[model samples]
Target: MMKQKEAALEFAKLASDWEWRLNNLYYITDKEGRVIKFQMNTAQRELFKNMHLRNIILKARQLGFTTFIMIFMLDACLFRKNTRCGVIAHNQDDAKRLFREKAKFAYDLLPDFLKQMVGAKVDRAGELVFSNGSSLTVGTSFRGGTFRYLHISEFAKICCKYPDRAQEIVTGAFEAVSKDNVIFIESTAEGRTGYFYQYCMDSLNKHRAGMKLTALDWKFHFFPWHMDKAYTLDDPIIVPQRVHDYFEDLALKVGSNFTSTQRRWYAKKEETLGEKIKQEYPSTPEEAFEQSIEGTFYQRQFEDLYRHRRITKVPHSPASCVHTIWDLGVNDSTAIWFVQLVGAQWQVIDYYENEGEGLAFYKDVLDKKKIDLGYTYGTHLGPHDLEVREFSTGKTRKEMAQGLGLFFEVAPKLPVMDGIEAVRGLLPSVMFDQERTADGVAKLQQYRKDWDDKHGVWKDRPCHDHTSHAADSFRYFAICAEWLRDGYSSVVTLPATHQQQIPTGAWT
Candidate 1:
């Protein structure tokens, strides 16, 4: 009798399990008979299960990122009592809608018995009140406060309204969570220099160092643009003829739809709707950022420069002798560029840059690099600063270089406009020797001007720093070249001439 009762109980439990699975709406079939399941790729799955304190999700669009995070937040609120979770969006309307939708969906799907655990009544303001004193609040980044679990949506956009608010909210609110607190910062790429972008990059660096960085506790998800299911990169028969034809047309107009490696897979999957849908949604953070943000640097000149290879160093000869361009610094990094003049072109050969070094150390490095002492160059400012009291050894910067057996030339103080124009003129004429001057070439390519739109003028301030050493050196060289051509003249003056008049010894 006891054995029979146990068997009967086991049979009932099995039946209950099957019934529960069948009743769950998330597992149920849609109108078309497709299961409404959370379809996550391998990467997305890892991100979902991640429990790092500081996490960042650099993801593409339409991979159910918002939904996944919503589920995670909900689980936290449900399981942890006396804990507050805050979801902040770019605006209030979005915050309200997203919170309400997810909460209602989760609420409606709960089993009857589980419904008893729902502590708080849903309010019009989109706040969820729980029985265990735990609550979930949805608010805009514009309104700042403390939160244990803080979710920032579209942080890149948040900067548009409250430029400093993003930083404030993260540091001020998330910092207070203190114990087992989790802060999630997820967004596609914005501009290269924005606060969100910087944060993401900083976190990435910390992660690489194997440090326990709160920022590294986050995950990054990136989906490629071509992963959309509705798009076909290749295949004429299995893929819809229209989508295939459209994709072909798009490829012709916008170049290849398939990245080099994906060409074959894209061709095979073209018949399937998965790639097309992914393309529409974008599976990579880079792809999403590219699609969502127009006029971004992602596909612009910045990308080109970033992808360009650095020039390498070559053997030194009298014909390709290296010259050093010096930009002296005290606390900041003093930069020196190794360069060679090839006909009209200047090829940067190498670079030595560092901060807070003694004059003797710099001299040793110069000696080691075999820098041409005669070719050492700097702006006229070098001579002036060489006269100032040194922070390290009470010697001027000029004296320091001289102590290293380097004879520094005080190239004339070319006006900022002249220096800018000279560098611009030299760029086209310059041909970088990739092997011999890797660092110097990098500095040249990275050199940029500070433009002022409001004043309609370029700033006269010197941009010479660690990266600008080579560029400043080239400018000084250019100025010296101009001076030498004009009989060592202090300033260049244009001679006025009549168009019709033909002077003797002057070729037309």
Candidate 2:
């Protein structure tokens, strides 16, 4: 009877204080292969509050952040009724370990009497269930079902591993989760490319500008190795000269004068990793995400445009003619980039995209661009692929469009790499409309080399994902614009009945 009273009092204490419950109840395997109590350090505690709900943390290695978040999510599943939480790892093996070795182990160590009160049971399907209806499941990916909580571990690695599927994964995961629930995505930097890098940059930019950032906007959490007190060595340590130079440069840039001990610890650690030390144990967020990944073709270009305010409001010019560039797809998405030549600048005034639509539908949209927006049509540019005859109509898309009076020119078919190079060269001369070309800008940002999982490296070939259509349209624009710049491209205006007509001049 006395033991039961004591158990009830302990359960009450655990139920009331989440922090205490976590530190006292949970256990994790330490580096020496012994289970230790799950107590969060000062840095971990600060990170917990910052990421209590929604976050994207770019952290140094071995900070136990992933472990701390796992326990927080487990707390939600145990204490709350009907709560459904998900933990997503980069792969199957990691997912299994996270669910079984971490989450399940914590639950299994709970007092037997306390487990009975919550009706805790081992779910055979890689989940923990309670009679009160709360549950936590772990998987490599989450789709279809709505979840109350979601934690994506090593998200940057996932982005590098599955570059093509990253967008789809993000879309599906966000849609499946309920509103106002915690969604934490934490990772160390893989490179200066990928979705994670972009996300952190955007968040950091917003936070720095003191903009209105909320739960809907992902909060940023960056943790350097020096923030952990344990990183300091007790004995005398000699720091390298390069480390001193780096800290000196960093102090000038970010106004951070780190202690000598931090430098010594980092220098000692760097000896083991050599050049990889900056990427692995960075002092600042910028240093962490500094190294550009190989095959990230447009990262520098994208950053330049963003930094220099190239992505801004480019209003429609009634005096100028609107030229539409297209990558037409039969069964897939067709993307159109509206470009208006303003003197020396290529003003990307708008963008439109659709799937499962005919040429007639697009024709209607182009007609509306003039009638509705009071802009005049200059010319429409399309890739050479539009000349391929269709099996159903026995006519090419360009031929069909001629009847609809939306004439298209066959852009000089160049190698894909050549087109990409042209786009890189042309980005400086181009200006994007923040509101109108927002989607197109994002497509440009995400366009990257596809990871060859079998070879464990990125291939030279592009990934045919959602971004492909839009990027292809932009590529077509670049190729045609190159012709214009080189004094080769001629805009031909064709009649409805396939009659020869005089070519038109450039839009002025």
Candidate 3:
């Protein structure tokens, strides 16, 4: 009985401590006079209150992301005293709304005793002039200034629309702030090649490197659509069926973006309006990418590829010899990829890609690498245009390859659709040996479609110029191998209706 009483007292003391902490923490109230407690989920709450570094809040919608930051800013101004907080949004309207809403809410939530201490009045414009000379200014990228606490909302969109201005804000204004300051940049995923995405990648790298960045300094937050516990597959029965059908068709057509988690989430949200709304605001990186306007390569196939670390080099094998593919470029680049075939798996082993170079220079690289000339392969149709054009040495591409002591086999020519289909079919089946073909594998993974808006189709535009020669060569080899497997005596010809119509200007 004594032990039970002691345990009860301990529990009571712990509860009292928590209550004290909660009471001291700041809260924002809505216009209804009810105190709005920032209730975060496991991830959201953990991230919000984290004092480690400036926070990066990658949030799905309705996660109270903006609200949380606003409260944090308010706490800084009220408690820290003399703190200069700046909120920058994609445009003036966003900045104004965020500042106005947050300031008004916070001002209303202030206790009467604290309200009496309001030294400066809240400007109708949403700028709060505090008594301690600290001020909070809400401005767009156009209005530049130094700040102790800088909040950047929808930074990815801002950077895309105005790259120069975004750079100025990050480098000129935000960087000038003291190290002790907080700069929170939060946004969803843009394409993988944007400034915001690059920054996030760099921050992640820095984090992995054990660099200590404040929550505001270098943070990446991703709130995918699946985190909402209220979401359930039993709810929106039709949504699951529709989503599944869509994914099935999509996978058959373009071959990506239907992750297991995504399917589950889609099903869960189908029944409930809230869950559906949350789907529009993905909470995790994978969800965001899958639902992104450009779509993503995060499905089972991509997952398997990533897991196997397929984008690495292949080890040298005596039985496995290297074969090359060449996409000859004069104005663009001369690309050559070295690949090794081991049983059914193909590995990109090495590469030599460049432009405007003499045949001797290329020959030297080939000799240095000791690549066997017999295994080299190139387009069967040849660099139709480039092959006919005379270089300064007056040698054609065939002559150039010969002069470089490189043996070249003509790659089989197929209809454009056939080539594309071949690549698509081969990608999932190809097992890359990373040790020998790191560069080549990277190119393959990054070989993405050029989204055509007019036709609403994804067209393959050859990419990886720096390392694509080898990839092109490998594709040629794969095409030939596939041809042999199918028992085709010659290149399989598609019907005239399936032939790709090359644009008139494409040659130039």
Candidate 4:
């Protein structure tokens, strides 16, 4: 007795809630690549309910979170008119796969009656247009577009692989979406670094601080492997005694009701993968970030600094003389670290880095800062390279600085590794001004050794990138401190034709 139009309307009404379709109507490829009915697991359900306004998800592997997001976007497009939706994957291949295998497969599995109502075939560019003029496009780049709904899968990977592009996307993508639009950013943790990690932490902090979370700001949702019901095993006899004990301890920590079969699966999986299991199927967010991080040289030392509250708002005391440590670069970047040896500890009051400028510019900047902050200059410390005469000027950089008011005290040339070690020793007593030294702090934390991908090991040398200049400048500071402590002198002599104007004293 059901009319065709009435039946279609009823079905369309049911499709409004994605959870209903996921449980009863949707279809997808199962674990064995067999096409089967899609079912909402425990974690997915929790995630679905929690994804409101702006959502950022940090999820473990094989949880079908990406698929859920894709399907949810598609459902919105089907019923709504002019619903501009998009899904951007980390890489080109992932974008293609999501469009071809998942989105296309889900559409193909739709009932003939429903497919008739939602008219239109997919285009060549992985775009599916509905009868109501709504469209969903999957691609690697979605930087420009007035999108009503957008989901960025593997966002952390994007931040790691393409940092500049990620920055552009972060800056541009949100502004394109309307005020009430939805934007979901989901990814597994790459490391405890990058903007992605900062965004998640900021979201949590804002939520805790009782700020109203809106479409403008993201809300974090962490889904570990234990929350996914399918992660457990059906076989109970295979669990090892060691695995059982480990799971028992972990359960006590996480408050999970551990089953024998779950322990067996983890044991068998762990045999194939030792620590990688934790990285892939993490039990917690913290564990995920800690497990697979590339060996960062100063991470532990910096973390200790953070924990002991050394990295805080340290004001410049007018009573103490402020020292400047410089890494001078003509064509490359120039960096400087401002420090004051306060009583027993070193207070890093400020930091500055700039490129494509002359010595006069830096001098003017220094003069301005001194005037602005009421800082009495102690001495300027630069590398031994300052003594080298430039081809054009026919005078050393050290001579040029003397022409200005900055009398340079040359730091001893030490091996880069030795300087890094000195920095590790100095980190315990270093106090930084959080706002003034933000860039310097980040550079130090991220300064790391070059990774040898082919050899699967860290290279002996440090990675020289944008971070290197700041790190090298700080290294010079460490060298200067060490030399001064060991009774080194500041009276450095270079070639001088006439009477030199360079001043020398306690700065060494």
Which prediction has the highest TM-score against the true structure? 4
lDDT accuracy of residue 317 in candidate 3: 56
lDDT of 2: 0.77
Candidates in order, TM-scores: namely: 0.44, 0.61, 0.48, 0.63
lDDT of 4 by residue, 101-188 (tens): 8787888788777688786555555778888888888987766769988888888788765665677677787677876888888888
Model 4 TM-score is: 0.63
Question: lDDT tens digits, residues 176-264, model 3?
Answer: 56677677777765433345755766666776688766535666556654455543343333344555785687566544555565666
Give all candidates' CA lDDT scores. Answer: 0.53, 0.77, 0.56, 0.77
Candidate 3 has a TM-score of: 0.48
- Residue-wise lDDT of candidate 1 within 44-70, one digit each (tens)? 466655547767766544455566566
Which candidate tops lDDT?
A: 4
Assess candidate 4 and give its lDDT: 0.77
Candidate 2 lDDT over residue span 360-429, tens digit each? 9998998887788887887788888888898998998888989999888766566777778778878887
Alpha-carbon lDDT of model 1? 0.53
RMSD of 2: 9.4
